[model samples]
Target: MPSDTEQRTRAAVPADAVTEPLTDIIDPDNFTPRLLALLSNALVWRESHELRRRFGLGTNDWRIISSLAIRPGASATEVSDFIGLNKAVISKGVVKLVDRGLVLLVDGPRGSRPMYLTPAGAEMHDAMLPISMRGQEIILADLSADDIDRLNALLRRMLEKTRELHVLENGSDVGADD
Candidate 1:
């Protein structure tokens, strides 16, 4: 016979559970992945609106600048992998940046082509850093220093575990390295 707890759970399940709203299936607050992604996207979009107006830049442009700032001489493939964006998107952005004299694609050894930021691109990256940092500060303002440290530690662990799952499922970065 089923245990008391199992019987209670079975009784609580509806015959037509699909008839219920999605919110009933998974409450927005309780859906960790979706909640985190949506909230992060909303905040980024809000923060980037003014940046777009002032810099004539969209998300891709900022991503390119940010990536090159950290890892100069990164190929489009590397940038795509690092930024969690597709190569096609990174390619398009690289084309734009190169045309604008913001990024340079240098021929590397063994027929490899790597990109690095031009002086103008470095300046642009420096300009955007403050805005990005301010947005982060705004989001983190309510958290205590200890809370921020703890959250960062937890997020790092979660990211590492997620990366492991990705490698296991795909044997590589699914969206990276073509």
Candidate 2:
């Protein structure tokens, strides 16, 4: 006999609740991975379009800028690690930012070049902050504060699990080279 907790959990989702055939993989309605991918892709597409239309910036550009805004004087490698982006991509974005006069690369200790936002960069960050916040607000409008907190905690746990699985499968953590 199943325990009460187990019985309740099983009862929460009836066996017949899933309308699609069990063999149908990649069902967005039933597969969490597919749903998550769809959500991420939609969000990225919308954000990229809006940012490019309003500020002539791409999502990666905004990500780099925002990362710098939070961690000023961070090196390209550090920024790449923090943002989970490819080092080459981050380096290219850094060069573009520097050429646009929005970022400054200063020589740091041990030959590492640290990046900082210029005055114009800070101004642009401030201008773009609202759009970013609004996008978050729109997406999370249905979730309560507690729900949002719990959702973030769950996502963090999933990220940690992903790293662990990567290490187990590949003998190295994800983005270890980056």
Candidate 3:
């Protein structure tokens, strides 16, 4: 009961052949979607470390705070949408920020309410921006200016294509299903 990858490996090489590094066999010239994903995750991890050290924040909390800074006075739902976080997680983040005096909930239209960054939250966000920028600069330093621009464009196209494929296969629209 060989797996698909194992079956392919067996078919490709003789039984007596020595195994080579998977990376070597795989053509690096052919751009893999996985390389884009690995790069994205590495950047995220680097950014998360900076946030943890400077702001004592986790990835979830950093996203919440960053979204609020980008668009001040967003409701829980709005923040959730902006940061691509679940409603429950956003609720918890808001509560935690409120307890720490970093955010405040204000009244909204028709009995609805929204959350806004407090003075403390604004100050923390401003302080964090430079640290986050440094992380970005370090991670992207390996790439030349042209490579950075090309990579950004290619990544955007890949993301869009993935979204389209998901929609085509699942017959469901993105975000609307959730």
Candidate 4:
């Protein structure tokens, strides 16, 4: 049974919501994953350039900073897992952040290094937040708040599915070498 809001939302969808039939499997436009990858690549490429120009940091660095901002004292492995990035990539980003005086790595239990943002790092994160939020707003300008929420929910579900598949394939030792 659908809630009243869900029913209304479904009813409000335009008739053209269903796109044209995909003519070929190999066509990029016909593949949802390809389209998603394209979007991710495009967003990362654009943001990386802007971040480098303005902050002397790459997207990965910003990601690490953002992750630390939210989860201070997280380990590189933890941040890597949370961010769905490789551990090596997270480690490299952490190194860069530490060298730049943006992040501090402290000894943790069992030789694990916990990472936290320095005051400068917090400032940097604050400065970059508006740009990130504005970009999100611009990209989502066409979407209603309900639509954006739904889209995010769907994306999170898809991410969970990917994680399930990865665990199945990797036998729970995900990124062991990374």
Candidate 5:
């Protein structure tokens, strides 16, 4: 009892249709939420990488620097955990940043050590702030404040749920939150 157009549309679909490996499930035809998320992450990463290159720093170094900016005098272990990088990588990054006079190492109790941004590093952070804000604006300008807040909440929940799923799947901690 369907119309001719409906019959044609149904005929166009294969009964045993298989999905392509390279094609995105969410973006089978056009932009989807998952595709948008991936694109957003890629764009942000690109911008951050560009900023790091301008500052004579690597992405990892910039990440550590930014992390310390959030909470100065955090230990290397804390930095590593926050940045989601291994200790060896964080150690090398901290050494490089220290060598460049951008960060200071403070001795803590029981032989513990922590890092804080120096004046020069603070200046760099200030310089990077505008660029980061601009990038964020461009990425989220079309959305309303409420939309952005909802999207951010959803993304955070997704991250937490994904971590839980990962733990269940592998029976090991993801340690995503540092």
Candidate 6:
């Protein structure tokens, strides 16, 4: 089932949508939605990778930091479930974060341990924020202000639909890495 926004933003065959003939022989003139998505993701990942190299942060460490920045006091398992990563990977990141003084692990009821970003972690995330924003700015530089807004609207709808599909496929809001 699609949301109202998703239902409204069908990808119509517009003149502007197809900039050039796709090299792919299949899929009707080689227009692959995935190619666009992957290229966009790769661009973002490059920024993230550079941030990690500069800050000495691993991918999992960065993910955990960003996740905790958004939803503090979440357990490693919860973080894993939230990010669809293996619990072991989350646990490793948490341990490293704790050792680096970027995060703190607190014992909770029923033997559950919750995590929070330390002040240092918060600062690190704040510092790295500009890199992510710059990545977006560079990626969308060709689009005008109005086109940017329209792109955001369409992307948001697509994201919502994908989330719904993820939930339906997994049968839960939390995806299991296993």
**Top-scoring candidate (lDDT):** 2
CA lDDT of each candidate? Answer: 0.84, 0.87, 0.77, 0.86, 0.80, 0.80
Model 1 lowest lDDT segment of ten: 16-25
> What would the per-residue lDDT of candidate 2 be over residues 1-178, giving only the tens digit for each residue?
9999988887897786874577835656888988888877887788888888998888888889999999999999888888889999998988888998889999899999999999999998998788778778877999999999999999999999998998899998777675
Backbone clashes counted, model 3:
0
111 in model 4: Cα distance from truth in Å?
0.9
Candidate RMSDs in Å, in order, are: 8.9, 11.8, 7.4, 14.2, 8.6, 13.7
Order of all candidates by lDDT, from best down to worst? 2, 4, 1, 6, 5, 3
Query: Whose TM-score is greatest here?
Result: 2
Per-residue lDDT of candidate 5, residues 1-178 (tens digit): 9999989988998988753465534544465666877876886787668786787675677778889999898998887767667878888988998998989998898998988999998887787767667777886889999999999999889878877898898875464432
Per residue, candidate 4 scores C-alpha lDDT tens digits across 1-178 of 9999989988998987964677754866778988888877887888888888899998899889999999999999989877778998998888888999999999999999999999999999998776567668766999999999999999889887876887888766446554
Which residue pairs in candidate 2 have backbone atoms (N, alpha carbon, C) closer than 3 angstroms, thus clashing?
A: none
User: Model 3, residue 159: what's the lDDT?
Assistant: 66
The TM-score values for the models, in the order shown, are 0.81, 0.82, 0.68, 0.81, 0.71, 0.68
Model 1 Cα shift for residue 29 (angstroms): 2.2
Which candidate model has the greater TM-score, 3 or 5? 5
Give per-residue CA lDDT, model 6, range 119-144, as digits (tens): 99999889877776786788688999
Q: Choose 3 or 4, whichever is better by TM-score.
A: 4
What is the per-residue lDDT of model 1 for residues 11-83, given as tens digits with 9 covering 90 to 100?
8999966643665367768899998898789868965786688787777788889998999898888888887
Q: Determine the C-alpha RMSD for candidate 1 after optimal superposition of all C-alphas.
A: 8.9
Supply the global lDDT for candidate 6. 0.80
Model 4 poorest 10 in a row by lDDT: 169-178
Q: Which residue runs of candidate 2 sit more than 4 Å off their true CA positions?
A: 1-24
| Residue range with the least summed lDDT across 10 consecutive positions in model 5 | 19-28
